[model samples]
Target: MTDTLALAGRLLLAALMFAGTAQKLASPTEAQALLALASLPPWLIWPAALFTAIAGIGLALGLATRPLAILAAAYCVVTSTFHVLMDDPWQMTIAFKNWVIAGGYLLLAAHGPGRFALRRD
Candidate 1:
């Protein structure tokens, strides 16, 4: 039951990562705009997409679970900066959401990947 729940949580987070990556690829305009707003290079979308894909797959496969979760949490905090700098209420909400997601990742990191993981540690 514990392993199952851990796998479920990992899968959910993986889905989020894949969905975000897909959105970036399918329609990059908004992401690019956000990059511009943050004074970051628009071309960063490609690397970001790649990172998400790799991290998502890693999470799904339960590979290097703790490290990946920690990295994902850091990624969330870093990305949230774009939304944090915005003056709009909606953007602020997004930033808060990112932080919450980061917290989840942190918990996952602390919990390990359970017995269902491909590489447990």
Candidate 2:
């Protein structure tokens, strides 16, 4: 039961990241603009989106669980911090969600991805 719950969480987080990936790809120009607002390079939009997509897949499949989870969590923290710095009221919710998602990843990291993980170590 615990393993099943953990798997469910992982898949849910993956789905969320996939949605973000799609959004990024759908509007790279807008994403680039936002990245610039955060003092980041516009060229990173594609690579950043790809990172999320790949990490999302790995998280769902339980492959490279620990490191991927950490990456996802770090991504969340960085993005959320940017959003907070930007102080966009409209995007504050997104920042909040990112932190919440990061918490889930942190928990997954601590829990060892449960029994359903493809890579136990």
lDDT by residue (tens digit), candidate 1, 1-121: 9999999999999888999899999999999999998788999999999989998999999998899899999999999998985569999999999999999899999998888888988
Off by over 4 Å in 1: none
What lDDT does the true structure give each of the candidates?
0.92, 0.85
Model 2 spans with C-alpha error above 4 angstroms? 85-87
Instruction: For candidate 2, give the lDDT of residue 90.
Output: 65
Q: What's the TM-score of every candidate structure?
A: 0.95, 0.90
lDDT of 2 by residue, 25-67 (tens): 8978877877888788898888889998998899888998888
Winning model by lDDT:
1
Query: In order, how many clashes per candidate?
Result: 0, 0
